[model samples]
Target: MGKPMVLFLCTGNSARSQMAEAFLRQHAGNKYDAHSAGLNPQGVHPLTIQVMKETGIDISGHQSKSLNQYLGKTSPKWVIFGCEKAEESCPHVWPFSLQSESWNLEDPVDFTGDELEQLMKFRFVRDQIEARILDWITENRIDSETEN
Candidate 1:
């Protein structure tokens, strides 16, 4: 199968970016490969883990990565900015990617509410990203099965 790639970037990989990473990786599966990085690295958030666990996706091993690590380290077909902070703070020269998009999503870290409310937002964002990514994949790529 051909490699289809995507990157999710944010100020901190703890919440928004990580959730996007975990969600896309899980939902996209073999259709696309996804990764997340932060402008300034920080450990993954506990709430991020808690929220993802509800959907049976484990992100416990996902490390908060600095954008520097990915700057010249990997080639992406797509690069996505998960928050406005990442877009504004991104390096002067973006590492080349075939497709780039910014979702400008809200960071759930500042979300103050009961546990249920926060989880609901997490799930909502996760599902939204999955839908968007899958739509992009479908529109831009042809599945291996259809190549013949």
Candidate 2:
């Protein structure tokens, strides 16, 4: 059997979902296939690229995708919503998903501030997502090379 698929869904594929996907792939690529999409499909934010780069994960090539892309094609074992809005918008019965849940991370795109502050907000959200990914990996006992 192939690695289980994990999908991160959010209002915009711009930040939170993007971060979660990359972190999971980096931390536990051996255990799961990570993918992400958004309800609205906003293009990935510039800050999202910049922040992920800070962690040595280059998401510059990642594109924002719509939920429709996966609706009929893939079966994700786990579907995680990065924000409340996406969770609320998601259908109660997600097809082929064994588990579904929300993380409710703040949308850094919604944070208002100057350039530096805006970057900081993105970094903060990125860190939060990474931490959650690490925790989830540990809780599930996913033994990846990086965890050794």
TM-scores for every candidate against the unseen true structure: 0.82, 0.93
User: What are the lDDT figures for the candidates, one per model?
Assistant: 0.76, 0.89
Count of residue pairs whose backbone atoms collide, per candidate = 0, 0
Tens digit per residue, CA lDDT, model 2, 10-126: 998999999999999999888888999999999999999999999999999999999999887888878999988998888563766777888999999999999999999999889
Per-residue lDDT tens digits of candidate 1, residues 22-116? 76767555666778889888889887888788779888888899888877777877788988878877734355666677888877777889988
Best by lDDT: 2
Give the 10-residue window scoring lowest on summed lDDT in candidate 1: 139-148
Error of 1 at 56 (Å): 1.6
Pairs that collide in candidate 1 are: none
Q: Say what the RMSD of model 1 is.
A: 2.8
Q: Model 2: residues >4 Å from true position, as ranges? A: 93-95, 142-148
